[model samples]
Target: MLTYVCFLVIISVSGGNAAIHSLMYTYLATSGIEDVPEFMTVGFLDGVPLVYYDSNIYRVIPRQKWMNMAVESDYWDKETQISIRFQELYKININTAKERFNQTEGVHTYQVMYGCEWDDETNDTNGFHQEGFDGVDLLSLDLKEMRFISLVPEGIPTQNKWNNDSAWLENLRFYFSDLCIGWLKKYLQYGWSSLKKTVSPQVFLLQKDPSSPVTCQATGFYPIGVTITWLKNGQNHHKDVVLGELLPNEDGTFQKSSTLTVAPYELKKNNYSCVVEHQSKTFTEHLTEDEIRAIHENYLPNSTIVGVVAAVLLLVIICCTAYMVYQKKIESESCSDTTRRPKETNPSVLFLGETMLLAF
Candidate 1:
């Protein structure tokens, strides 16, 4: 299994009146590994991990708040059983793969990623199923031909066997065309409130010193779609620019970075800026004294300071709100029966309504 995996979300989700969304699951089985799980799986929706299960965990666990709905609805139990089946199946698959490679003992992996993508705008759907051994493709599904195709020479026999099974072919057809799409749509419906919301990125420019590269970082973005580029003189980008991968934040938002490498002499003569495009908004940060932040003195950036202050303020507000509610509750208890307080409405239900997935 890859160490820093975000799952193989084959299709990137695009935004519009009706955007493209994808649901993918990756199953990985490792051979002769003591520190890691023997089998694991991750499920992604629109490039975000919604659920995960490892041999050690032994049960499916929800990763997002919206995913808790599955637990409340008892879907997680069914999923856990399915994952257990895959855990056993993939172990055998990995052993077969090792035998095919003529290896007796070693650390290796057998991986599979399968999913379906739907364009809500056009009502079009696409499905994919790919398997790999030791990070190289071994077999892939060919939907048009209704068969599994071998990607490597060793996979030919397995591909032929899978293709010759008429019942398996029919099941595959129904799964990709109907079952997968139905499940994807149902998940979308269940989590649309959280998935549809978008948060603008907070951009920052950081540098260690004058000779160091200037990194323009954008954080707190949602939807997992963003572009970061360096511009020179408001037009083309600087000669040396490195774009980083999109990563998830602890708060479920996303972050990305673009770095500009230039000499100090070049910095004074030309104007370089970092431009970030997310959703329908554009943010630009220039390389200047006011924009650049220094970390040599162990000082935090303005963004970090602001975030800390905001968090404190939010805590204060929540405390005040709770205190006020407590006061009101006391008044009610004095005026009416104390037992009635227990029957009062839950604050979470009142505020979150049906949006609350699970609190405990």
Candidate 2:
């Protein structure tokens, strides 16, 4: 159940103007867990899942159809081999982590999130790398400083050692600066036809009750970038409106909602409407007292604003969970085998560590 929520993923919409494309990978390894694999890895491109690997399957499987069609069987054959190698390394990682923390038992995890972003309009590229133990960041790579930094005192030793290793640092430099970016571009090129696809949004006006706020909902949209605004009698309105986060549908589309608080008396007198803007489309949902009667179809009665947000989050969040699919038992042991020697290391996979390095 270890979770890390530090990375603020700047997702992009494919058909939007000036989209920042990204490629990110998350690796999780566990110890002292049942019904969960010893290691798992998931890769994302522009917020869509691309590849998934786990100890249970001992294979690197594409999560999206485009990915499978774009890549060859030999590519998967090579990736499976690499993933199998990494699984052994991750087992050693878990064992080593327990020793560093001085914990003999209980479930613990090592997680890493590393990736790069490319701005299509500007051709600018950025890299990100970070790792933690048991859900807390222990070491994160700082490309600007060319160093590993530890926010907590306990991680200082490992940070200093990693920074001092020139060969390892140089490999990381190449890994992020060139290799990661190269891979991202290749994937984008391979999947351009599929990645550039877009689906228009469908808008709805909903009210939970006469006393509750009226909500404007936009669902079944692709690319994920959109805006919901309130218009009062043809003029832009901004008062007492709450916007929801972009949510993913099971079919790869997106959804969002915005709530407007207006008195029943005003609803009858004033013309209030919701405007949703997405790629090449503008959807306007006009609010009416008649729409209030439709509450039974789509509404959650929650007084507190926090509860409303939480309720919205709870509705589809669990179904969209990317993790929690692992299958196996884990050992309460030491850390991983030396990371494959940096030289001749494959660029397809790069796994950072909390307290250990593969070895230069």
Candidate 3:
């Protein structure tokens, strides 16, 4: 009974398509093959090889020999040994105990194979090998020049898993589904980070002219394998972008930058941001309308300061004039008093009525 259970487990594991596809991809990658195939609905495409998954770069290869060398140099599945054959070659039985390869000229093309399967001991040597289709030709591909393209796994979601106790299978399904989704999300994030580093070193923005719009500028680098953009409110800006030079770094990495003319209106408000796209991630430096205003906030005009000082001086003059007017009024009153002849009658008044006064 134990042996029978083990047999059933083996069959079940082998029959899982998802598990099988994962193993197949890993096996081919380690086989030192130059051309990495892209998975599609029908099969896989080997013409355009995947070079960097993070950058999503792929190159096309025309020949099969380069692919073979790449496979042999890399570590492949120890238990799996793949076979290949050209077109018009003889075919083998599908049910043969050992796994075999099939060569065809369909949309999905196989460049290499490596792996093994369970089979009978007596007929192990007579196992079926890979067979090919007719008129499928090989090209002389150069490994170095091949372009690399990024391929994203299909149907992968980015979400957390749910739990339900109504059915045991529901819980199992949620676990597996969420696991794949989480993996894909993390994988993409890591790839983007790596890609950003490879694209450029440093970038910045500056004012083109005091009167003109704010311009994005860079000192240490040129744009390559990356995009430079100016944004307003999370939208792409469609203005002329000025590109800078690619400067050398001590660490052997390249540096580049770009500049854009912020519209006069936008600059007035100071609502703008510069975005650098390397790989799938974006690095953004932003200035809000308030921020831009603040940059020049302290720079008051000389004329304005002078005007303010003049107004203050005028206020002081008015106050002084008022005080002068009050003093003049007091001085006029004092002068009038001094000029008035003391009533002239003080001494002479006695003599006037003397005759009548003598009788008294």
Top lDDT prediction, candidate number: 2
Across 83-133, the per-residue lDDT of candidate 3 in tens digits comes to: 111111112211110122232222222111111122222322110111111
Q: Can you write out model 1's per-residue Cα lDDT over 1-360, one digit (the tens) per residue?
A: 332232213315622233788777666677776776787766666765667677887887776787666335655665676567666767777788888888859777776666778888889987777677776567778877878778778798887776776644554555567656766777787777767778899888888887888888888777667888887787877478887655555455666788888998888898988888988589988888545744334433443332321222222222222111000000111122323322222111111122111110
Give the candidate number with the greatest TM-score.
1
| Residue-level error in angstroms, candidate 1, position 23 | 2.3
Clashes of each: 0, 10, 29
TM-score of 2: 0.66
Error of 3 at 33 (Å): 49
Which stretches in model 1 have alpha-carbon errors above 4 Å?
1-11, 14-18, 31-38, 70-72, 102-107, 289-291, 294-360
For all candidates in order, the CA lDDT equals: 0.61, 0.63, 0.26
* Stretches > 4 Å off in candidate 3: 1-200, 212-224, 245-247, 289-360
